[model samples]
Target chain A: WLHHPASVHQDGITVEGLIRRSLEAKEFAYCPYSRFRVGAALLAHDGKVFTGCNVENACYNLGMCAERNTICKAVSEGYRSFKAVAIASDLIDQFISPCGGCRQFMREFGTSWDVYLSKPDGSYVEMNISELLPVSFGPEDLSMKKVLKIPNKY
Target chain B: WLHHPASVHQDGITVEGLIRRSLEAKEFAYCPYSRFRVGAALLAHDGKVFTGCNVENACYNLGMCAERNTICKAVSEGYRSFKAVAIASDLIDQFISPCGGCRQFMREFGTSWDVYLSKPDGSYVEMNISELLPVSFGPEDLSMKKVLKIPNKY
Candidate 1:
């Protein structure tokens, strides 16, 4: 059985249900240029769920990725820690992993995060952030500058 | 006159010529996934130039931005400090700025990097990284972590 980090069933919420919601959100994807639609669902540390889709632009450089969009949405709403993420793309026949850059971005949020990918039949594969990004770089590598900035200078 | 921070040009290297080369590199863009191709040129600290284009994927989340690709190529080749960058896109009619994520990635290399947006008429708009990502987050922010391992600490 595919495990959702946190399942919701108030009034109307289920794994299949949320996946469908996110898939519907894919329609809002602004991929006029690429025609590849993607959607992401994020579960916050506090159990709040937020969803976002790729927002493309005429200037492709300015376009936002589904993962980045979800991160920005969570950050803007004041959520820092993430418990889970689900990404879906309708273009390919099989599920694929997030790109290197997205892995870096996801690492910025935290390493304990879990990621899910959906099969066409609605089943999914699950993995933790560590599995996705092994030996990642993060806030820890910048220690020297902080030591220099502190007034104590000890 | 435009300023380049860490550029190293040979006896005959010109910014105008580099821009043209970057534009040509746009043809190599793997944007069948996004259909919006972008190419970038980086004038490195060692008087060498690097060029790259967006490599999109069927899984939209697995694509790299033109700027990130250029930076990664330079970093992989041992060039961390960037003097200037030129970006050209085929889809957008107006100037397109790098997304916030790219801005932060650029900051990781150097906060004072120079950025140029190329125009079809052979002219370009030059701006520094500070102007592009004002009050940006950088390596310094990473130093505040409670533990070096991130989310694992929680």
Candidate 2:
């Protein structure tokens, strides 16, 4: 729930480096419609960094966000635990924040990890996943008992 | 847009076979959270079939639906145009319909493609993406001129 954290992340990587990689990851974006290229560099707990770019589809909702793509790339490669993820966009004035969907995707791993929202200028804002999605739904919610359903057909 | 199509698909595959593949695909589901396994078998115009199972995450929203997984798997392997997609679930009596997100995802390629919603007991229904997500937002919407935003900060 930080308004703006320090320049150095607790994970030992400089914010500038992660943000730079995220910006570089934008080169792989396949956005032909909106042309809003986004990139993310995810730091796995095992000391590996996975970079990903937004992959847009003709169906807007089917487009994969940069953050989620980065996470999925890591997960597909068998890296589940994350340390931090830095997101970058072309905006120079405003910091790039993750969409609600990406927030939930990042929260799937852990809440305490760092989320760096950066602009092309390298300036950034920081927040944890829990801050982005407060009072969130997690895996435990699915384990609850099913409620009664009315038999009336719609 | 269909309500209940025949047992035969226009692409030359039988409905029962596709549904059976979907059911078999469910065996690879990685849903440790919800335990609600779902599977999808996507048929490409080139006569290739790609199957995928739901891959859930600890964060509920991060869970990838079987439909999307199937699409991504196909896309990753260079199959773009889809002819049909059959979905299956363990429910014995009720057909398994795609969620709002999945419906939007399917509409990315085309609306006329077949979507088979099948149950464990072999009973099923059929529909198209147009019927599932009417008046859907798509890639074209992003090309419109941007609306002016209010300057007031919250």
Candidate 3:
């Protein structure tokens, strides 16, 4: 556990190349509207890495975060389980953090996966999905039993 | 404008085939979690239609709304401009409404496009993007001038 330099590294999670790939992916950010670029590198359970950058839309709320972009691509490509995800941005004062929507998206798979929020200088802080989204709403609440009837209120 | 039936049709916007397509698309919803299915059919400016159903993830927040799914698919297929979109759901008591996230996603294109929120009985309520999300944040808010420098706070 390299706890010095004010960085938290997760147990058994190798972040050596993940952080760098996220930084590289930031170059592809289509953020003409925000001018705020972000990138992510997601490591699947099978050891494949998916890199993605923020794709902003004309409507600010439609803008997809780097974390969600990579995760959704991985999901669409048939990757269900993931090991870790590393995020990068140009902000030097504080390490990059996933937005609320991205946090929810990351929580969709499982909670124990590592998330590396890194700075341009490679310093990083690690946290799991549960820590990021406490008391989260997941699939269980909607589907309890095979015969659970939800209140029909749209 | 079909006023007495409580269904509003936009001037020169055709939604006859769109509503049926949306309802048909609902059969394909990948919603093992919520059990609440939704579907959308988007009409591009070039007379093409794209249909999508809600794709739910084990993570509740990661669920992609049908409206967004159709719009994103259309956008990826080189359809930047759209005329209208019709949404369908099983709830017959009231017409289905887009979630806050989908409303924002729909607003990404423009404020003038029509949205037909429909019930299983083929009745619908029409509203525009601006009516759904008022005083919205858009591209102009971020990129106002060529020399606008945003506050550098992460």
Over the stretch A19-85, how does candidate 3's per-residue lDDT look in tens digits? 8888988877766777888888899998888887876677655666777767655554457689899
lDDT at residue A107 of model 2 (Cα atoms): 75
> Pairs clashing in candidate 1?
A34-B34, B6-B83, B8-B47
Comparison by DockQ, 1 against 2, better one: 2
**Displacement of the residue A148 alpha carbon in candidate 2, Å:** 6.8
Question: Model 2: iRMSD?
Answer: 4.4
- Scoring only the A-chain of each prediction against the true A-chain gives TM-scores of 0.78, 0.88, 0.86
Candidate 2 TM-score for chain A: 0.88
Q: TM-score for candidate 1, please give it.
A: 0.57
lDDT of 2 by residue, A1-154 (tens): 4444446655677777888889988877767777888988988896688787776776655677888767755654456789889999887788899998888888777778888888887778778888888998776675678788668998
Q: Candidate 3 residues B1-154, lDDT tens each?
A: 2322433334333575688889988887767778898888888887788887876776655667788767655554446688899999999898899998888787777889988888898778788899898998776665566576668998
Q: Which scores better on lDDT, 2 or 3?
A: 2
Runs off by more than 4 Å, candidate 2: A1-13, A144-154, B1-30, B34-54, B57-62, B66-154
Residues A2-107 of candidate 1 have per-residue lDDT tens digits of: 4455565442445565566556667778888778787877777776888898887654556777777888898998888887777777845666456666778888
In order, candidate lDDTs are 0.73, 0.78, 0.77
